[model samples]
Target chain A: MLEYFEILGQEVYKVLFLLVPILVSVAMIVWLDRRVWGLVQKRRGPNVVGPFGLFQTLADALKYIFKEIIIPASANKVVFILAPIITMTLALVAWAVIPMSEDLVLSDINVGILYLFAVSSLGVYGIIMGGWASNSKYPFLGAIRSAAQMVSYEVSIGIIIINVLLCVGSLNLKDIVLAQKDLWYVIPLFPMFVVFFISALAETNRPPFDLPEAEAELVAGYQTEYSGMMYAMFWLGEYANILLMCAMGSILFLGGWLPIIDIYPLNLVPAPIWMILKILFLFFLFALIKAIVPRYRYDQLMRLGWKIFLPFSLIYLVLTASFLFYFDKLPKGNF
Target chain B: MIAHSIFFYFFSVIAIFSSLMVITSRSTINSVFFLILDFISVGCLFIMVGAEFLGMILLIVYVGAVAVLFLFVVMMLNVAEQKQSWFVGKKSNHLPTGLIVSILILLELLVVAGGWKYKENLMSSSTLILSDISNTHQLGLVMYTDYILYFQLAGIILLLSMIGAILLTFRKRSGVKKQSYFTQISRNPSSAIELKEVESNKGVIIDD
Candidate 1:
């Protein structure tokens, strides 16, 4: 009994260790995203809060805590409350298998990438529930748009991941990172990486692809009826999801936790720091994209995903598989 | 051992409870939500049983994609007004026939399961391999090497079905100026631009 309790306690501790940093980083990334956005637009963002507005998100979080939560009378109260919780929980849960370094993950499961993909795919449900539970037209419209968008993009994202999986011959994320010791997948699979990044944007509902939350038309989309801490939970969950995508981008393409080079000074740095830096670089690009690009029209977005990305990735998948087969360089460890 | 049993029961109980909720829920949308929960719990059960790849696929494909589509349709339907029980309501006259057919199918499924005994003489007669590799690898080995032809046939069937769906939905409207992405993208500056020089007194005549 004592031994079992010890194991449970250790597991709990490990989970907390992973989660606390993730939550803190989510807060930090929100500020980073804003600052980067501000930089692109040539303005100071939230500079009144703390040093360079470092504590803006913290202040916002505190404000959310003290505000009154308004639940619409017609709304499905249970689902409305459950929506943000589900979003935040699912977004955070996907991080369990994401390796920060060689062994910094909370749970190093065999099918880590599939687990991530599954959790991320399920993310649409939170928004759908929120939109439907709001019992309003705009939210419903937003939910409908997001449902189609996410489902469409996920097809291409699956194919892109398959391209990476083919070379590594493993669904394990750590193995994927290590497989890039000599050459990162970004070199050979550059087009797939771009598509994956774009899909990630659509998946997370960031700007340009954020038709679900297009402020111009939908007010706040699924979040229109949410208020107080409930609203804050959605915001936190969104940023965390963006961060997760950035982490995935770094892991799949840039090589998670691997230093830029194997030289003396580069090798001296810790592995997780490299991972964090790559994530930040990708996050920076995401911020820049929000500032620079105009939003795509709905039809155009679908065309890009289905008409272009689907066929492109499919052809690349076949080519990569055939090439590997012809060369007999397919990973021997695979069946 | 005890913990494994506990998890197994935990997931199975939730699965059964949620599946019951899926049918009994008053709201259609809520029923779809419960169905999603059912998928998730069943997926958890699969993962607990060591078929992690299949478990993840169940989560990704069914709970993520299929259930979302179900929820989408349910949401669009005036769900607040839909309180019809499964056994009753106007169009439910066929329910009896449906139940009979479903039960027959269930019995056939049972027969299919029991007929696996004859697989002892097949090439991959060993049902489960206790190999050190992951379940995905084990599945790939059996699926690709032994049943490659059947797999290819299944793929063709799925492709045909998808093409059929598109064909059924696709309509041609004569007046609609649909965006021609191919022509749009293929236009180079030389092809699209008319570098016409106009004389000072005579302007170039525009042609439609």
Candidate 2:
């Protein structure tokens, strides 16, 4: 019993080490997102708070915490309360398997990528539950739209992952990164990388594909009823998810934690910094997309996911498989 | 081993309790939610028992996709007030049939679970549990090598069902206009418009 408690305590400490940085980065990323958006529009955003408005998100967070939480009388109380918590928890929990650098992951399970996929796939429940529990028309519509969109895009993402897996021969994230030591997947699998990045945008419900929360039509969408800390939880969860996508893009395509050049000077830099830089670079692109692109029509989004991405990814999968098989470059699976 | 049993019992208890709630919940949405909980707990049980691949697949395929669709349909149908208690509705005739079906299913599951002890043929399969490999690699090896035909058949079955679903829901409405990007994009000035010399008193007759 004493040993078990000791193990549990150590695990808890490790988890806190991983999660604190993640949470703080999430807060910073929200600031970064807004700042990027503001810069795109030629405005200085949130400069009133601390130096360069770094504390803007902090102030906003405090406001959310101090505000009142009003649950509608007609809403389903249990589910209403559970939705945001689920959203935030699922969003954060997926970080456990995301390796920052060599041996930096919380859980180095063999099926790390699948675990991430499953968790992200389950992320829909939060939106669905929140929308349903709100018992409002707009939220419900938003929830339905999001549910279908996530499911559709996930198919292409799965195939895209399979494309990388075919090359790496293992589902381990570290193995995936190490496999790219010779060359990053973004070079050869360029089309799939583009598709994957776009799908990541859709999966995270970022703008352009953010029809679920289209303010023009659906008001605040699934968040129509949430306020106070609950609303902040959703906001926090959204940024965390976006960061997760950025990290995923970095890991799969750009090579997680691997230095851009494996030379003496560049390789001397810490691996985790490279990982963070890559994630930030991807996030910058994501923010750029949000500033530049217009929201997709619902039918247009569906058509892109289904008619274009689905077939495109499928054909790429076959092509990659045949290319590997013909050249005898396929990963000979044992380990 | 003790910790293993503890986790096993914990997940099994949650699975059983949530499945009970799935049947007893007043609202259909709540029932679907409970169904999702049941799936998650059962999936955890699988993961705990050294079947992590199967567990993740369960979470991904069933809990993620299947149950979400169930919730979507139930929410959209506005049947949340499905408050008619089991065995109270006038259609209580289903209770007898339900009980019979339930018992038959229980027996079938029991056979699947305990048959290895008694049935020689069932234990004769060549694929023994390989300890060295991860579950996913083991699955890939067996699935692609030994059970390749069966796997291909499963894919065919899934594809056929998808086609059947689309066919079932497909409708042809003549009057409703649909966007055809191909036709719209292919249209050119030469094909779409032609200039004609007009007679003095008449506008150009537009019949092609």
Among all candidates shown, the one with the greatest TM-score: 2
Could you tell me the lDDT of residue A140 within candidate 1? 86
- Per-residue lDDT over B1-36 for candidate 2, one digit per residue giving the tens place of the 0 to 100 score: 556667777888999999999988777788898999
lDDT of 2: 0.90
**Colliding residue pairs in candidate 1:** none
Q: What's the CA RMSD for each of the models?
A: 4.6, 3.7
lDDT of 2 by residue, A1-335 (tens): 99988999999999999889999999888888888999999998678889999999999999999999999898899999999999999999999999998888899988889999999999999999999899989998999999999999999999999999999999889899999999999999999999999999999999999998999999999999999999999888888999998999999999999998899999999999999999999999999899889999999999999999999999999999999999999987565
State the displacement of the C-alpha of residue A88, model 2, in Å, after optimal TM-score superposition: 0.5
The Cα error of candidate 2 at residue A72, in Å, is 0.6
Candidate 2 structure, TM-score to reference:
0.93
lDDT tens digits, residue span A92-189, model 1: 99999999988888888889999999999999988999998999988888988898999999999999999999999999999999999989889999
Segments in model 2 whose C-alpha atoms lie over 4 Å from true places: B84-89, B93-100, B113-130, B183-208
TM-score of 1: 0.91
